[model samples]
Target: MVMVMVVMGETATPAHAEPAAAGSLEADGNDEVLTSKFTYYSGRTLADPSKTMIFSGNGNVPLAEDIAKYLGVSLGNMNVSSFADGECSIKVNENIRGKHVILVQSTCPPSVNDSLMELLLMISTMRRSSAKTITVVMPYCGYARSDMKRGRERSPIAARDIMTMIETMGADRLVCVDMHSGQMQGFLSPAVPSDNITAIKVGALYFAEKMVNVPDSASEDAPRRNVVVVAPDEKAVSRAKEFWNVLIEKGVPEARFAMVLRKPNLEEQERKEQPQSAAAVSATSVDTDPSTALEHEIVGDEEAIADCDAIIVQDIIDSGQSMSNAASALKAGGARNVYGFATHGLFSRDALERIDRAPLDHVVVSNTASHPIGYEDKPTDKITWISIAPLLAEVLRIISEKESLNPVFRLPKEQQ
Candidate 1:
């Protein structure tokens, strides 16, 4: 939907009134930065001309628009609404028959269930309309936290359940951002084409330009450098390594890397010690402890974290517990600056509050998940939001060309 806002006529027009030309940045004598166009195409014609269509689901339309802009395309017309009984309804205004359709949606807060249901319905509609292929571009997978099952739990793995529903609803392919677990990628059935694109490169570029203070002549094994990449826990080693690799590509050779190990917090241990009947345990009582549920220990390169800037890298920051613990531990280990990067910032209840009390200088997250209202209004808070649209657009453009996504990761030439 195009924005229609009332503006006073005769207001002074800015120098950037005209759109910038594609693939260039202009500056009006150091006064303002004007971008002619933000795009990700590689000058390749579509394999099937006019056969590619992009649609926006109910959630996060602004992000979808950004992606469309990156592709130099407009969003396909679609009317999405609800019935009186809370049932989802949709009407496609453009012809998508026999077309390669990409539906952009992020199952984030406010109404995850409704957003997911609408996405499923849209896929089914497109499939019934003879769409050649339907790809669901979900930046934030809603049930990702429940990717694994607990001991003796009777319920199905929610992440798998969501994937099964999408595949069964006639979706031909799926594209998602940083998921909860890499193992979740294996759960996809053999027929469905899936890709778990990440924003680590995006975050690394930001840190390299704005945060890195490394020297150019440093060696690759400079483990005791000024800036260090940290994995909040063992589970995040791979993510931290990816960020480190991108930083290296961006010319931060002195940047080092480390990983943290977590031990259960005192409060969590106490709760575990208390005996409870099966009925009480089944009630899912909430733990009210304000402290992090875990304590961090530097498991790799302890010397690298001593008296240096530390950047914690992780895929998801749900409760911010592990982040909080890692920040405290890094500070206690004599780290001068503590920053964090999480691809998806779920920031569930009191997560911001917890981060406020932690020793972190800034927690940078991508716009894969929506920010809560007033998140930036706090007097002493540091939460930065980055856009993952360009990365998504690049991947989508590659997929549309029937090309492999291996180049996005800077893989070896033979692999590509």
Candidate 2:
């Protein structure tokens, strides 16, 4: 049995004996007392603010700062530099002995490898320095897409390898946002608890606010502005359905669901099964551009999408080819205004320009990953960024309090 007392204000200390260490297990045959200045009654031992430290790597510093600010704490002092030969050098400038440490790092583009290495090194440093526990807050988990081997090729399961590395480096837990595949959690060892949270609710709330004031297109008794949530591919159908349900719950009266069916590229499929011979080499001569290789057609309740506003929901928007193609398909299927929403916006290699020229009216993505270079100079209103700091902070707080996280998976009461 355990008892946690939350004292308010600067009052006199209770008559109870000195509380045990933050993470120490006391077995004196009496109820354990876990009290602190910033403690609260959350049915578990909540993290004391003074003893909780937050650190960040080179990836997404702004996000880390926002999370710290939300939690009413300052970030820990940590210096990360590179050696003469490009080796990572990390130094934690604060004493984290027996303290709960949270490290914020996203393995994103422009420095994926470096960011990962820095995180691993930081975890090892904290473990060796006698930290009570280390929690890795990785908003964008790189290499998540390489989850499985393709066909019969002997390919490395990079996602599993990365998870193994993090766990081996002594991370107690991991928290990531919108992993490409939910199965990636299985890649981690059971010792390292992993949380794969979603930013779909955040995205849904943003769209709900934008569509709240939209007047009814028909009579007062008729449905409100016709809106359809679209899944760009078969894998995204579940996500799109979740987004659609949230929109309706948020008062989007006429929200509907649709999906873009992709035609299999027979030629490409045949080439993959062929051997690495001259014939296979010549077969690759065909245009392999994703945007033009395969065809897409919108399939769903036709009445729900005809002349209705379409919003494409996806996990990651890398290169913008699939998004552009999905938007074009929706427009061709009688969608008036096509929008795109994704959790991670990895706009690489002219993706922004391609989106600007595409049929999409607007695109919204969470700030899980930092924007690439030249993103600000791009002259287009098609891109919007929303922050996931509040959600992440809430999750961190729940974890610190050792409470059930089922609440975070649902839409907030206010939004509902």
Candidate 3:
């Protein structure tokens, strides 16, 4: 093969990492100030000397341009169109033989069709052209939720199938934002440089800023005190640890770190014996009943929720039925302020509307998953969005410099 990725726009050179203490991964003492990562390096988009191919999907055009502007390389030649026969058509306006071709696309909504078709065609075209290296940057990766097969006689794992498709199509490397699970990369070919990047630091900084504004919001006695990070489900415990580490680096005392043990929701017997429906219809309003609160019914542990004043929630996915149920439990238990922090905000089936109805004080999801349409603004709703552009741009810069990604998190946001 060949290396032909959808093009990521070329941008300016990355900065050098200053020297640090010895024997520390902190600093490798490697100082080589560089400009751009491309083998045919230059600053202007239309002026690069190398035959690099930079192509962008309609959704990812802006990001591709940002990355291109960051790498200081000229854009490659590409023309995408729809034929009269209702088939997507593409023409390579430039030669890419033995050249590194980069392709950029966002696998967001309409993911199955637009993302799949666009990426496949782009890769197949570059592969046929014998490009040297092909890298793909999917900022909002779709089909990621299908990372695992929960039921049946073992059909294809969606994530594996997708990676295989890309690999078979001629992708030498892969880059995507917060995957459903980071370990999913292991299923792909080892030769493929698959980087599953995250932006916990960005979230941590946002949390820090929020803490500074309200000193005693999440904690009382120690206003500057750190709060526990919680994973709503057992599957997300790993992310909770990663988020805790980032908080530590951001100045949260280690003693404050804790993971809420994820327990199963009430099963059939527990609900039947508890007089669940009776409580909803009697003694309280309709809103108090878990079954009537959202479209789906739920019963959570109020003890677990009320114990914590503030919680750093890991995710809000899977119809948000669980989150809403859990939120009700928290309100009953004792949590004063409940805040959710997730890399992806996949609010499905009227989830945003229901979340607004919950007692939660704040919910923050990155700009990674398109902000859930109208979630940016709503009456009686508090939702904040953080950008992962800096984090992703940093990864590209480090890859170009042949540097380790350890420093990527430490680099200041302004530099990223």
- Model 2 stretches astray by more than 4 angstroms: 1-47, 216-223, 270-294
Q: Estimate the lDDT of model 1.
A: 0.72
lDDT value for candidate 3?
Answer: 0.58
Pick by TM-score: 2 or 3, better one: 2
User: Over the stretch 58-77, how does candidate 1's per-residue lDDT look in tens digits?
Assistant: 67776776676666666788
Residue range 290-342, candidate 3, lDDT tens digits = 54323232133434344454455564353554555556545554666666677
After the best TM-score superposition of candidate 3, give how far the Cα of residue 350 lies from its true spot, in angstroms.
Answer: 2.0
Give per-residue CA lDDT, model 2, range 1-416, as digits (tens).
22111111221212332432322222122221212221121222235788788898888887787677667677788888887678888888789999999999999987899899989999999999999999999999999999999878899999999999999999999999988899989988889899999888777766776543255453557556678999999999888888888888878856888888878879968867867887666544422343552388778898777788889999998888788888878877788888888999888767887788788887878888888778766545567676677678778989987878988786656521
Decide which is better by lDDT, 1 or 2: 2
Candidate 2, residue 128: lDDT: 97
Candidate topping lDDT: 2
RMSD (Å) of each candidate, 1 decimal: 7.2, 12.7, 10.3
- Supply the TM-score for candidate 3: 0.70
